[model samples]
Target chain A: MSERINSAWSPSSREKERAQARKRISRKQAVVAAVSSIIVIGSLLTIVVTSPGWAVVKKTFFDINYGREVFPTVISGLWINLQLTFIGGACIGVIALGLALMRTTKSPALTPFRFLATAYVDIFRGAPLILIILLVGFGVPALRLHGISSNVIFLGTVAVVLTYSAYVAEVIRSGILSIHPSQRAAARSLGLTSGQTMRYVVLPQAIRRVVPPLLNDFVSLLKDTGLVSILGVTDAVRAAQINASRTFNYTPYVVAAILFLLITIPMTRYTDRAIRQRTNAQNAEGAI
Target chain B: MSYVLELSHIRKSFGNELVLNDLSLSVQEHTATVLIGASGSGKSTLLRCINLLESIDDGQIFLDGVEISDPLINVDEVRRKLGMVFQSFNLFPHKTVLENITLAPIKVQLKSKEEAVDAAMTLLKRFDLADKADQYPDRLSGGQQQRVAIIRSLAINPRLLLLDEITSALDPVLVNEVLSIVRDLKSDGMTMVLATHEMGFATQVADEVCFLESGNILERGTAQEVLHNPKNLKTQDFLKRVHQAGRL
Candidate 1:
């Protein structure tokens, strides 16, 4: 009678003993793996330095300009690409929300919606983004639908949204479904309608779970906007390409790459911090 | 006593399997009746049927003498008057206990937030958990959360309480606290129908005890008569096992 349910979830005596033994075994295994990995990495580094390639790095580091002057055009183009990436990411968010909601429904009325999402993702993600922009820039007027004005920037934005929405939709759906079914039941039992349940309980939890992935998607979406250069959208990559054409040097891409790193580095740091926070919370509860 | 709730000849099926067969039950105003039976005895199904949570293929249910067969009967209205406590507390995890209690009153019933909070505060206090009113369900112990759940249901000021194994999830030390609260409700004369395996509580406090087996009522009588001198063999056998389990 001494609070029997306190024992409800705690493991029995045997389980506790087994868990302790397993921890000891794993700790020993971890030490062995760490020692092995250090040895292998040390050998590889030594072999690389002793090889002929070591001289090339020394030659380039000394002769080449370690810090080249930043070009204004490259900086301006980098800014333009940032704008396009953000704009494209925003559209992905809205479309992903819609597609995620549609994926949960079984109604025949939503068949076209499901099919369209599926088809768009397959077509663009299957073929490269370069081809999609080429099609949008060339195919629309080529089909002669007769005087339908198409902007390259708009077309690039649309192409990315279409391609990324399907992937984002799957991420969001998993987030939504990961929520305990009890949360929905509690909302319903409290007299909130199904729509209210989704809006309040389901969406809040889903959004929290998807935040890291959403940030990752945004970082990648920025890189993917480089493909819009083929459509002549004048984004960062396109501006770099224009500069590279004029200078007859690939050095312009290095500028665009730096800008891309600038954008993604902060996001990666934030993702790591968030993951640490989440794991810390779980481990804290586990300890309790 | 006038009947506040009644179910007549209810039958429910899932494909080929019949779950509730020709089941019928009645509740008098301001009296607690506890249903006792083994697992698969359809006790939980019967509770769901009472609230229309589970649809019965063939049956009629009446709340306050108004039949619920017509499409016009608002299920929400019936549920508002018949508070139910589930085995799992099922409190909204994201919401604090005060918000959990006040949500229905403010949103569905259209009461002002101030009014709903005022009412919820009283229930939280009565459960001796006023300090926990701002805490989420996950922050509370299982017993404390279950007690909050009971109070949340009662916050609606239901005409009758339907408890489905209310104390089943409780630790042994916390079981009496819940049962004591239930026993105190009897003094207030709140009408109730409890589905429970707590034989001692059923024998000591219930106005009537109904023994159900396989979706049918095997025996029923006043608590004293059913516990002390059941005439049916199934009832006697059930009592013997119940006692051997140290529950009688």
Candidate 2:
């Protein structure tokens, strides 16, 4: 009986043949993938390089020396974009959390605030980001508010924070709503006050569920900070605009685009990984 | 004697569907009261009403002889003295077993973190769940999760514990583990009101068994009197059906 059990557990010659067949199929698949990718990408590259205006296009957009020369200024300009994103992102997180809580609150004391939050989300989310930036940038300065600085950077940050807060708030609210009501009942039954329940039980879970969406907004916020360049904040896009117009070469524009991609692509990959990890965590045993 | 819990003419409705109609019951201190009936028989609603989870449309509830059904009463304050375990074992998925058990003690009762953790560890150890203290609910079997939930409610030292079909969601193999904890709690003299479909378990644990039909307790007696020799026809029919279904 022991011998039979061991034999049953061990891999047989039939199993070895099945494994060999699987390896053969996988090898064939890899070869096919490589051949198709090489053919498609090589043809596209050839078409672009052999175009009639390739010389002019390469000189204007792909000039390595000019790109190297402008890199420092554009990088310094990117420092401003980075500052805007971090500062604006922090402000948006706080404001959006407040808005989401306000919208979801059942307290009669917050009735007016809930109405205001709903209206704010509708207005800002419906309007384009650039339009809000232009309005707040030029409009706030025009109002000549005493305490508020007329600095385009400050004004631009405010506009970005305001618009992004609305979008992020909706994402957060959806997460809150997605949680089963039974969770709230359990918390409440434990004698946690409604506010405590929201703080301890609901918000922690809600915010966790919305992290990937929040990261997506963060990436968009980084790119949209370039929109502040319109207000003459000298961010990466504006710096590229200044350099490109000065030489009329357009290589600086390409350089700035590449810089933005350098940051965004990794963030996008991280967001995808976060989403996959969350899905796996949900399905995996002992997941925290 | 002042009762641990009392419901007088409690009436509740959800959008024209009457769930509990003029229902009333009382529980004595340190006694286990078991409610048994078929589905939609108002056993769960009565328990919910006692815990103040469901607002009474018209009635009075007295917890330890205080009229808690008054509209001006703070429901949260009342809930602090009562513990409830649900049919689905609604353990907070985000929290570890120990954290789930300690949450109410730390937050609601305002116990020191060390004190709550000590109490939680004691309960978990006693329940054979000390090893699962750091595991999330999804990592544990349904029985283990339900045991943790019972421990969570006990951490607050509630005067009255309300259990709404606590073992209804567990598999047959898992039900005994969960029911055994309640058996232990009964022997330890915990005041409890539970609705269940387990007739054999009810006979073992209940000091009093109430048979509910629609929204009324049609029969009330000791489990031997109620389960084995029910007087009301509805109670007998319900028991016969349950027995035929192999649940009794």
**The candidate that achieves the highest DockQ relative to the unseen native structure:** 2
Q: List the residue pairs that clash in candidate 1.
A: none
**Model 2 residue pairs with clashes:** none
What iRMS does model 1 reach?
A: 2.5
lDDT of 1 by residue, B30-135 (tens): 8899898887888888887776677789988888898864468776666777777888877776679998898778876789999999999987777789999899
Model 1 CA lDDT for position B187: 78
Give one digit per residue, the lDDT tens place, for model 2 in A1-288: 134455457778999999999999999999999999999999999999999999999999999999999999999999999999999999999999999999999999999999999999999999999999999999998998899999999999999999999999999999999778878888999899999999888889999999998999999999999999999999999999999999999999999999999999999999999999988876773332
Q: Pick the candidate with the highest lDDT.
A: 2
Q: Which stretches of candidate 1 lie above 4 Å from their native place? A: A1-72, A105-134, A137-149, A243-251, A279-288, B69-73
What is candidate 2's CA lDDT for residue A26?
100
Q: Docking quality tier of candidate 1?
A: acceptable
**Poorest 10 consecutive residues of model 1 chain A by lDDT?**
A61-70
